[model samples]
Each structure stands twice: as C-alpha cells, then as structure tokens.
Target: MASTNAPIYDELFNVLFVIGTILFIGMTALVIYSLIQFRRKPGEEGDGLPIEDNLPLEIFWTAVPAVVILFVGLYSYDIYDRMGGMQILSNDMHSHHSISSQEKVWGGIGSSKQESNTSRDFPINVELTAMQFAFLFNYPKGEIISGELHVPVGQPITMRMESKDVIHAFWVPEFRLKQDVIPGQPTILNFTPTRTGRYPIICAELCGPYHGGMRSTVVVEEPEEYDAWFKKNSKQTEVEL
Candidate 1:
C-alpha cells in the first residue's frame, strides 16, 4: 500500500526553519552589536547628530524584503503541490471526476501537470455537515453517523462540507490543510489519507458554547476492513430502523 508523504512535508518545514534561523541570527547580531557599539557612553550628554538620508541602505533593505517575500511565495506554492493538489481529501480522485476550476485555485496555487488528471479509478466522497459543536457525516448510503469517521486507505476522498448552523472549520492536522464548513452553501476539500490509523478530525473554528468540545475521529483502515465496518454499521442501523 502507498504510504503518506508527511515526512516530505516535515523536511520542507525544516528547510524554511533553517532560513528563518539565519534571519533571526542576522537580525539579533546586528541589534546586539549596535547596542553595544552605539550606546550612550559614560559622561556623555544627549548630543545626537542630525539624521541624514541613506538612500542606498534604504534600497538595500527594501530589496531584501522584496526578495524574501518572493522566495516565501514560491516556497509555499511548492509545498501545496506536495500535498497531492486537490487530493487533500483522498487518493481515488483521479477515477471519479475531472479537475474542475475550484481545485486549481483552492489552495493558493494551482496544481502541477501530473495532478491535473481527469479520471480516477476509486474516488471516495464524504459529505460533512457542521453545526454548533460537532460535524455529522453522511455517506452515499444515506445513513447519518457521528463521533467516528471511517475511510478506506490509499484512496482519494472528496469531502463536501456545509454548515448547518454557523461557520466551522474541518481540520485534520495530519493532513496539513483545512477548509471552512460554511453556512447555507457547500464547500469542498479533497485529500488522500495514506496511513491506516485513527486521526483526529477537530473543529478548528470556534462556534458556540461547546466549541472547545467539538471533536471527531477519522479511522483509516484497509479496504477489506473498511468494507466490513460499513457492512456492520449498516446491519446495526437497519436493526434499529
């Protein structure tokens, strides 16, 4: 089975951190050196010199920030591609639908050529309805469930979320992305969860009194295991009905 690409994301983060560390060190060194060297000396009165224009220095600093901003913009875009483009929901996306305009612009940058494939083999669709505190999941079978979410591993899952009451954020930290569950209208997010484990699906947005308690679990199991679980849940649900 194909595994999750979290390590690659972590490595990218480490790279950015290295750059940040360099910036911090450079700024700190400059500040410390200036404080010690340009401090008001002993027995010295406040005889400050008039400030003059340093056009070259100003341009240098301005250009530095511009370059830094551009680099950060490009680096962030590259990371978005690594998360499997619109596959933010699951792996089987290529089999189900074509690449619509939304996927291209949803996560800041557009996807790569390899990610723009139209057809897929096994697409997973999950409809999420968010309310005051928790999210309700609706599968194609029309059964409503709560608490835990079950999905088959190594497949693309397209999550369509809508707010039942107010705005809510559907976030899975492990997935490294989130989309708001808006009111009245539906919002979509896609991802392919590679690992077969229980991942927390938290409501990152504050809704109401029980906002802090809003939580759910995402269980990623093997294909067979997922099918079995669904069958069992269906039988139990039918018995209740």
Candidate 2:
C-alpha cells in the first residue's frame, strides 16, 4: 500500500489520461474524415457547396466542449481539495495573520477533508534539513539526528523542512508528496504512512554537483519496532553529540 493520498492522485491521473485520449482520437478521426470527404474529385469544381452554419450544429459543437471543460475544471478542483490543497493554501494565508492570533497556521499538505472532519491524533513531528549533499532528519523529542528517516506505520507525520544553502525538493514517489525546501523559508509536509516498508527519498530539484548522491530512505515499521529503533538511535546520537 502507498500513502493515504496516493490513490487520490492516481484517480486524478487516470481521469485526465482518459479525457486526453478521447480528445486525441476524436480530433484525429475528424481531421482525417474532413480531408477525405472534402477532397476534390476528378471533375470537382470550385464553390461546390456554399453551405451556411446550422444553429443546432454550432450550438452542439460549442456546448460539447464547454461542458467537457466545465466538468474537467470542477473535477480537478475537487481532487485538489480532497488532497488537502485548499488546506495548504489556507495555512499559507493564515501564516500572515497577526501575531496576536492564537491559532497556529501550518503550511504544505495538511489533513484531507475526511481527516479534518474527525478528531485526529497528534502527528509525529520531524525536522528535515536539506543541504547540498544530503538530508538530515532531526527528532526534536529525543534530540536525535540521523541521515535516514524512520517512522511508524499508520501514524500521521508532519515534517518541517528547510534548506541550509539553496532550494531543494523533498519528494517521495510512493507518498505522492513533494515540497520545496528553500533557504530562510520553512515549509511543511503532512502525511500518514500506511505501508510498512522502506521508501526512497529523492531530491527532485537540481541542486549542485553530485545532486544524485543526495538521497535517503524512510523506513516505516510497526509501532513496537519503531519505538525500539528510535530509542536505540536516540541514545547513540546523544553519545555521539
């Protein structure tokens, strides 16, 4: 299984592919038919038929495309909203709110519509620092620092990311999540890992030399396993520090 929102992205992609295929085939067929049907025969003359436009035909062609566009626009917006796009936008707008405001605004992808309606458990907070050659994962709770990220399966996570030098992107294909990590600009990524396995974390942006070497892994395991690993790593990190 992929992340919770992966299926949503897949659904949208499938819809678009189908729509594009239909339009391509239909338009190609029409072009071929018009070319052959209107081609001059051996004795064909000029101005064979000065046909005027039919109101119903014109209306039909215009209405068909208008309806298709409307449907596509609405469906795309719905998918975006379901994937927490609106929530992210809202958080960004609220980030500029006055300091006196009590509520905190978080950016990047937040909870989906269904997740937002119900009560939610506290997400696992992880700080990600992206540099030229690597990504560092910092667990603030235990003061742990590691090159690879480790998390418990089926648990919500909120990753706060920033860049130490230049702009970078944190992208996990299975999770269908990508966010920019820019210098002096903090960003957030929220998701719930549904599968218990390891996924590669890649820097989708073109950083500097050896950008391909800037890669990591995220291990998602059961709660017990994650707890044990976290404890052991945190202790080791403390000793090294």
Candidate 3:
C-alpha cells in the first residue's frame, strides 16, 4: 500500500470522516434534547412557547456548514493538484503546441511539455487499453501484456490509458489512483511505487455485466528483477509471434 498519493488521500478521508462524525453526533444530541426538554407537560398542552426565529442561531447553522463545505472543497482541490490532477490544465493549455514527431498524442489530453521533457533515466512509460472485462498493458519496449502490470519499485511510471469499448475506470485502491478510461478520450496517471509487491487493479466503472470480474494485478519489483521479467516476457512474445 505504498504509493505517492496514498497519504494525501488518506488525509483527505480522515478530515471528512471526523467532520461527518462530529456533525452526526451533535445533531443527534440536539434532536434528543429537544424531544425531552420540549415535550408536552403531563397535564395540559396547547402549544409550546411561540418560538420565534433567532437570527443568530439561524445564521450560525447556515454559515458554519457553508464554511465547512468551502474549506473542504478548497482543501480537496489542493490535495488533488499536488497529486498531478492539475496536469489536465497543463495539457489542455498546451494542446495546440508543436511537438516532436517522436511524441504521440492519444486523444483529448496528452502529456504536457514538462512531462515530455522527463528524464529517460526513470519514469517508465506505458499504455493501457481498457475493454469490457480486461486491461491490456503495453510497455515502452513494445511488449504487450495482459492481466497484470509490472514496474520497477521507486521509479515513477506514467500510464496513458483509453477505452476500447465503452467507458471504464482504472482504480488501484492501494495506490490511491483512479482515472476514467473514456472512449475517444485519453487520460494519464502518474505514480511511483515505493514497495515491491502485488496489488489489485480494479475496474471502478459499471461498464457491463462482467464488470466486477475486470480485475488485474500490478507487480512492483526490484529494478534488476523487473528487467529480468521484462526481457523474459519480451522474448516469449517474440517467439509466439
């Protein structure tokens, strides 16, 4: 469960959870108190005090939640920006900029200029294709694999993904990464795996009847081991073709 964005997402979730708990408890307490304290007298009951609206209380209730919601929205946006969500703006703004022939554009959004200039040493590039019930992964070296994605630990990996059929979603709960795979629209997700292990890749979209079965695994391995795995798979693919 080690990923660059996991902590940020966790922090956001904690904030929301705490606020929701406080609101629930406070509201419940007020409801129960009103039921007991404002209940009808034992003998007679025509009407309770002609309660008039208190401007301060009304304003407090309205303004407090409004402020809380505003704060949460801003905080969530900041966290999302830090997690590379702002890359969408970068891509959109640079959509018409000239790029090298070596660079490719998938669809709606492509890599930003800054992302295109990423060093070749790390940050391996990969393409993902989503269909009805499976994910297809293509490595930088023209190797194609299905059912699992592999990358070296501690190195950033950028995935450019699109859907082959209807809309789909790629989600890895541990990585705190989830992005829509839209038909005719390409999207990108970048993350660095900090640990070596296997984690599930789940389709978080309701695409079809078998959507629940659309699951895969991501394997993070040591650099040398990942290289070995890649070479072995590439050679096996060559033989099959």
The estimated TM-scores of all candidates read 0.74, 0.77, 0.83
Count of steric clashes across candidates, in order: 17, 0, 0
lDDT of 2 by residue, 1-80 (tens): 36887888889889989999999999999999999997899886667677877999999999999998999899988887
Task: Tell me how candidate 1 scores on lDDT.
Answer: 0.67
Q: Which residue pairs collide in model 3, if any?
A: none
lDDT of 3: 0.75
Task: Tell me the spans in candidate 1 whose CA falls farther than 4 Å from its real position.
Answer: 1-12, 40-49, 81-121, 142-144, 235-241
What C-alpha lDDT do the candidate models reach, one value each?
A: 0.67, 0.78, 0.75
Root-mean-square deviation of every model? 6.0, 5.2, 5.1
Residue-level error in angstroms, candidate 1, position 223: 2.4
Which has the better lDDT: candidate 1, or candidate 3?
3
**Candidate 2 segments whose C-alpha is farther than 4 A from its true place:** 45-66, 88-106, 113-121, 236-241
Candidate ordering by lDDT (highest first): 2, 3, 1
- Candidate 3: regions farther than 4 A off: 89-120, 236-241
* Residue-level lDDT tens digits of model 3 in 9-124: 89999999999999999999999999998778789757666888899999998999999999999998877766767653334322222323434433221122223243344457
Lowest summed lDDT over 10 consecutive residues: which window, candidate 3?
107-116
